[model samples]
Target: MPISQAAQRLPDDAVYVRPRMAHYAAVSRQIMAALENISPSVEQASVDEAYLDVSGLERLIGPPETIGRQAKHIIKNTVGLTASAGIGPNRFIAKLASEYRKPDGLMVVHPHEVQAFLDPMPISALRGIGPRTAPALRQMGLERIVDVRQTDPALLERRLGLRLAQVILNQAHGRGSDEVQLHSVRQSISKETTFEQDIVDQARLRETLLWAAQEVGRTARREGLQGRTITLKIRLENFKTFTRQRKLPAPTDDDTVLYRQAWALYRESGLAEHPVRLLGLGLSDWQQDAPSQGDLFDTPSHPSEHAQTPQRDRRTRLFQTLDGISNKFGQNAITLGLRRKT
Candidate 1:
């Protein structure tokens, strides 16, 4: 809903303020960090929700229930907030189990109890069954998960496409992927903004790109990641979008390098001649345990190349200091000014 409509429907005592995305993002990062301590195979489904696969740690630690309790306790202690956990055979059953009890609750569904647990639930409780699909399922007398399981496969396949029908049937049987993907390198971290008005000034565009690069670099650093590719996105006033990319010699989580590379890509794209309606900056091709920037070229072929190490180290220290301040206070508490080119 639009803010205006939401305000109109609000009560007289309602006090709404603008969303603080950066603050929320910081908190989400903290929560994820706490979760990582529980299991190495943690998949972040969203900012607040995640799936942890504790497949073969029974001997090393404890059962799934104990692991779930520990996870909730760790999150509460570390992030100062309560978290819900659901332990099941697979992601689908686990998601349903998580919602079975809410507001600091833990529910564990074993393999033997999967059918008993899902049969009583509504068809809508199954993932991918939205408002439209729910109505269709209900019309077909598939009001519950058990109904879906009992319904004719050919009937469902004719109604909903073969793939979707099979998926729904599979979910009804409480079958889903047990794989919990760890941090994936294919995922890109990005920031983008659409201008209130189309901007023609090159300086303003560069400033926007720099800010976005800074944000991307900060997020990557927080996640302990570095990327070898820098991508720049530009949208002209006519709504035509263009993207340009460049690969770095080594992976980096430095805003300086990001900004320089992104800016270089933008210039090479030759789209700057048009007024820009939107600008974006992204870093991809993640390297989890990348070499430090200073050490990247440490085994320099020449003595002159070795001199760059100290400067790199100094810049790294400076950025680390900036990050510390930002984390302590706020994202905008300190920022590097982008100097205008002559």
Candidate 2:
């Protein structure tokens, strides 16, 4: 049945939901808090999914299945939501096990059972194997996960690209990474939006860039992060994507600085003359701590000297005030003047 039709068949009492960013953010925080109590090593895969490293907890928590059940109970009791748990030697196996029996189910894959567990599944079941790639694999007589495992890596590379084939081969043989990383390990934060229709107007494009920069800055501040590099991503109407990046003299979480850098990169791309389908802004090369304050006589290192000026300090304070107001009232309570469609 079509997903839309199935959704309509549900009773009116069913929670027909719409996407709300605040609600999702709250839930994500709750989930992270819950996991932090269970294991010190927790990797958030997405807003709704995560990976927990429970390797050394056997003595305290009993078995892997017991740990899974306890984790589920905590989430249900605390967050009012039930979570599916997957326990395995590696993340790939664990992720697959979790999805195999979902919606409040628990599945455990022991070290010895990894190959057997993967044998019957189709190639598409593997992570990173998209619909387009799956058919090509099947055409090569590699139908099941077992077939891919038995195939030669050299031949696989010849058919698929080198890097992707190696990743698939490693996954097929039950060799997968199990390191659950914390959020601090992330290298970059980005935001992108695809337009409903191609946009050609320079003003609209600039407004979109400003919005993307604002979002990146907001997220960075929330995460207590600041980056030196600001990257601009533009996808033309023909679906050709291009990216340009600029490094700042000092790391910053100021949206104004991010917007200016992104705007500069966008102009340098020479795509202003073409219609755009998508726009993105990213911040990377994170600083260990907040940017340091410079003395009056310090030589300027970057082209944007205004970043070290008192005006920039004032702008930063204004942004912080606006952020507070937005948090208390709502996201749309205040908007950047540049983001306004003029």
Candidate 3:
């Protein structure tokens, strides 16, 4: 579904950085919380639907439907959001239940009822079945779930890869046995912006990069980490997009380095030529840079003793002198004229 269409079906007025993604992560969390008894269960997945398991939770919640109704109520009341819940013997069944009526509905599949519940749903309803695969199945004359189930397991395995073959056959029979790994490792943090108006303004663009750098830096420092790679992403008015990245000389938590490198890359990319509709920045491959005690001037260095190449020494001294001058005065001590204008 188009993001806007899918979003309309959601239970809440959730805020999303990307309007088209139809992401309602916050509202989804609120709905999960309203489910009182099985609330302790770990939330498993957050795809188009959530695959939450409420199997053994019956004893605490009076019944599975009790928890389901409560979850629905919470989504409606507290979150002003709507959700459909599927209660089943396992993750797969629950996902199937949620799909029965998408955009605010519920389904219950008791262990004994799993088969009857699954048999009627189309193959496209199964999680991994894609549009292309569904068409291929139709051409092969295996149009329904039962057809997939009745096909020789070995034949299905031969046609699809072994793993997919087993999964498809299992779904056809309303018997999916995917192990739930409640814990997943964190990878990276990213932020993206869709501009109100596509832009070619260099000054505004530079300010945006600076703002992003400060935000990313504050987050990284607060987490007690530093990133080695800074990435810049841009989408143009025509919708063509590109990404560029720069790896710093050393992993630094310093905002100055990240923003400088990111800005340099943006300029070199010639993105200003195309009015840009979106921008994104990401910091990744993080590690702890040693805690900075103070600035370069804070560390004591003796100017009295000098024993090195005079030419190299002169350049180093010259650079430091210029830096001191800028620190005491202002950055306009050095001026870079704009070679191009928007």
Candidate 4:
């Protein structure tokens, strides 16, 4: 159902919140750090999902089951969150096994038990085979992974594209890459909000944009990253979504600069006339550990006075003070003013 319809049906006292993505990322980092203590070969699949290569630790850890249990124990103790772990010969079976028993459960599929564990499962259980692809497979009388393995490769290829068919076939047979990536970098950071009621006031929209920019900038600075592009996302009451972005003269991790850029994009888009249901802001085109000494002291020419050299240092110091206060207290302890008071 559309959010509007869902909203209509919800209880009057239902509560909503702007998700605290930075806090969640902090918790995820703690979880990953704890897991790394068990095995150095840990690949974070997502914020909550990860793959750990414990094959090398079987001798010391007892076996796969012992390793899985230990990993779960560490996560629960470190983060106060329950985790599901799957152990298998390869990544494919392991991923499926993880989902098989979820929310503080563990399932291990040994090398000899792989086929028996996977064959009876529905074809939809195969990764990448979602609703759209499942219907096609069911139409072909392929209801199970065993059925897909029995089906001809040529016929499956004809129904689905060659690449997808090959990938699905490989997963159906319990074959997948076992290599775990120890390090990964996030491509982007974003924050968004959905309102319980549609809003037409431009001031309200800009206020929300300011909040998003502050959070995005704070997260970027903490991670030691800057972005060359700032993106503004809008979703109207009718559910039509649109985005506009502009590249900066250089990279920045400044909240004021991010808000100014996003606001400029929003005005150019001519979207203020419509009632907005959702608003989002994002920073991307990552520059990790970008040199900033020159940017801080020598500012380039720009239409906004915020780019002037004197104000540039002032802005930097101001944000540094803000971060200090936030760290000592909390994110909401001190709020940066979005506009000069009359």
Q: Give all candidates' CA lDDT scores.
A: 0.83, 0.81, 0.65, 0.85
Clash number for every model?
A: 0, 0, 4, 0
Model 3 C-alpha lDDT per residue in residues 72-100, reported as the tens digit of each score: 77657876767788878777788778778
Q: Which residue pairs does candidate 4 place in steric collision?
A: none
TM-score of each: 0.63, 0.70, 0.68, 0.83
**Stretches of model 4 off by over 4 angstroms after superposition:** 1-23, 237-240, 291-321, 340-342
Per-residue error at 135 for model 4, in Å?
2.4
Candidate 2 clashing pairs, residues 3+ apart or interchain? none
Model 3 worst lDDT window (10 residues): 291-300
Q: When superposed on Cα atoms, how far off is each prediction in RMSD?
A: 6.9, 6.6, 10.0, 4.1
State the lDDT of candidate 4 residue by residue for 1-342, as single tens digits. 755576567786766565666688799989999999898888988888899888879888888889899999999999899999999989988998998988788999998999899899998888899879999999999999999998999999999999999999998889999888776767888888888788998788888898998889888988888999889999987668899988876788888788877887888898878999899999999888764422333546776644336656677788789888998999889876767321
Question: Best by lDDT, which number?
Answer: 4
- In angstroms, how far off is 109's CA in candidate 3? 1.3
User: Which digits, one per residue and each the tens of the lDDT, describe model 1 over residues 121-201?
Assistant: 988788789878988988898888999998999999999989999999999999999988886444889988777677888
Best by TM-score: 4
Query: Which runs in model 1 stand beyond 4 Å of their true positions?
Result: 1-8, 11-15, 191-210, 217-342
- Residue 212, candidate 4: how far off, in angstroms? 1.4
lDDT preference between candidates 2 and 3, better one: 2
Q: Which run of 10 residues does model 2 get worst, by summed lDDT? A: 291-300
